[model samples]
Target: MRREIPLLITGIVGIVFVLQYFIPHFPFNRMNAWFSDWFSIVAAFAIWLGALNLMKISFQKVFRRKSDWGYAVVIIMSFLLMAVVGFAEGKGFRDQGTAFDWLFQFVYTPLSATMFAILAFFVASASYRAFRARNFEATLLLLAAFLVMLGRVPTGDVLTGFMPEGMRLSAVASWIMNFPQTAGQRAIMIGIALGLVSTSLRIILGIERSHLGGGD
Candidate 1:
């Protein structure tokens, strides 16, 4: 029963949204907006549920001595600390004064920047792994990727001293980004759109209920 009700509701909501792209009538538009607002409220409740699940899982890990559970402790602590400071201080970010502001600006911002900066290293590592030459196609992909990366920086100009006239270095880079690259991106987007449509049709018709908990 717990699983069935939510699945039914989700199916109905997904169908309505899919219809909305084709039907631009007032009823569809209004219904879509109301449904979106309702979804947002429900999403907030789901966030609370997620926070509860996180706390439970982290506590279980601490009890069992799972590998690197201390990191989970840090994750849970950071969320709780931010929640406490935000609520206990005042209302929205506007009213949230001095100390909270300092914490948000300095502490949270620096940690977030550093965390995202670490992703550059991971991206470089992944590019290395993915760029290995196994065949002609793979070699071409690797070469193109190297060109794109080089063209993003001053390195391209240094290496390609024969850069053509009337095309500034940045303009050459912009052409690479805008023309063939964007066309490829558009093609990929079209494929993604089709996949989304098929998956959504499946969900709307009750072919997918995996998001619901195991049935009792």
Candidate 2:
């Protein structure tokens, strides 16, 4: 009964949302708005639930003296520090000159920047492997990437200075980006939309029970 009730509710909500997109009138539209409001409210509570779960797991790790327990301690300290500062500052916690704002700007921003900086090396390594010309299709990808990268820089212009403007590397790169890249992106987006529709249908029909934390 526990699973059945939720599945029924999900199916009804999903059907209404689908109808609202096609119908876009009266009851369906109103129901869609109501569902959206409820979703927002549930999302707010979900965030708190997630934070509590995080803290609980961190505390358990610290208490058990698990591997990387020191990181758990740091996580707990950071969470509590930010929560206290934010709550103490009331509505203006995010405004300039507040402790929360200062921590976010000076501490969080630098940490995030450093994380991304470290990731750049990994991204470059992955790109090097992925751009290797192991096959015909791969060779084409490598050529496209090389052209795009060159065109983005002043060196490409200098290298192609002897060529006519329309025949230059930059022009070729621009054409590739404006046509081939846009076409690929649109195709990928269409594929993603179709995938989402199928997944949504599965969930709506109760065939996808993974979200309910059960095997189908």
Candidate 3:
């Protein structure tokens, strides 16, 4: 009954949402907004549940003196510090002068920026490998990427100054982006929309029960 109830609820909610898009009148019109509110309420509870679960694992690690337990201690302290500050400040927690705002700007922002900066190196390394011309298709990709990158910079225009206006690298790059890139992007988006419809129908029909935490 436990799993059956959830599956029934899922099927009903999915059907209602799908119908609400096409039959936007009377009860269906209001159901979208009504369900959205319920979704937000559920999400608020989910956030609390997630925080509790995180603290539970962190506490267990600290009690066992596990390797890297010091990091868990830091996590607990940071979580508590932010939560306390936000609660104490109440409605003004996110205001410019508030401690929560200060911590987010000075500490969180810098940490996030540093993480992304580190990731930049990995991105560049991956780009280098992808841009390598090992085959005909790869060679075409490499040339397209090179032209696009060069076109965005002033150096490209300067280097191609002797060439005719339409025959310049920048013109070639713009054509590739507007025609080839846009077409590819549209094709990918269509494929994604089709996949989403299939998966959604499967879930609505209860054919995909993976969300229930086990295979059928």
Candidate 4:
């Protein structure tokens, strides 16, 4: 009964939502809106539950003085600090000059920018190793990347200065992106949508019950 009840709820909700897309009648729209509100409430609770779990684990690690527990302490401290400032200041916490806003603008933004800048170097190193041109496909990929990168900078114009404007590397790069890249992306999006529909149907039919934790 435990597993059966969840399966029944899942099937009903899925079917109703699917019908709402096609029907779009007044009653169905109202029901869909109600269900969406319920989902929002559930999502809020889920986030709280996740935060509580994180706090519990961090507390345990800190209490036991485990390896790298200092980072766990930092996480808890940051979470609590943010929450306290946000609650005490109410909507003003989001306004400029508030502690919360200062932390976000100065501390978080700079840290994020620094991390991304460091990551760019790592990505370039990885790309250099991957583009070794050991095989025909690798050589083609390496050349494509080289053209794209070069065309994105001023150096490409200097290198192609002798060529006609229409025959420049930047023009070729633009064509590659607008045609081949766009087509590839559209194909991937279609594949993703089809996969989503198939999985949703399986869950709605109760054929996929791995989400129920443990069941036949």
**Candidate with best TM-score:** 3
Q: In order, what lDDT does every prediction score?
A: 0.79, 0.93, 0.93, 0.91
lDDT against true structure, model 3? 0.93
User: Candidate 3: deviation at residue 56, Å?
Assistant: 0.6
How do all models score by TM-score? Answer: 0.74, 0.88, 0.92, 0.86
Number of backbone-clashing residue pairs for each candidate, in the order shown: 0, 0, 0, 0
Model 4 lDDT-worst window of ten? 166-175
RMSD (Cα, Å) for all candidates, in order, is 3.8, 2.1, 1.7, 2.3
Model 3 residue 66 CA deviation (Å) reads 1.2
Give lDDT tens digits, candidate 4, residues 1-216: 999999999999999989988887888878878998999999998999999999999999999999999999999999999889889889778999898998889988998999989998999899999999999989988998898888878888789989999778888788778888899899999999999999999999999999899758
Query: Model 1 clash pairs?
Result: none
List, residue by residue over 78-104, the lDDT tens digit for candidate 1: 878877877777766435555678788
Residue 214 of candidate 3: its Cα lDDT? Answer: 83
lDDT of 3 by residue, 88-133 (tens): 9999899998999999999999999999899989989999999999
Model 1, runs deviating above 4 Å: 1-7, 63-69, 72-80, 92-97, 149-180, 213-216
TM-score of 4: 0.86
Candidate 2 Cα outliers beyond 4 Å, as residue runs? none
Q: Model 4, residue 23: what's the lDDT?
A: 86
lDDT of 1: 0.79
Worst 10 residues of 2 by lDDT: 24-33
After superposition, which runs of candidate 3 have C-alpha atoms over 4 Å from their true positions?
none
Checking candidate 2 for backbone clashes, the offending pairs are none
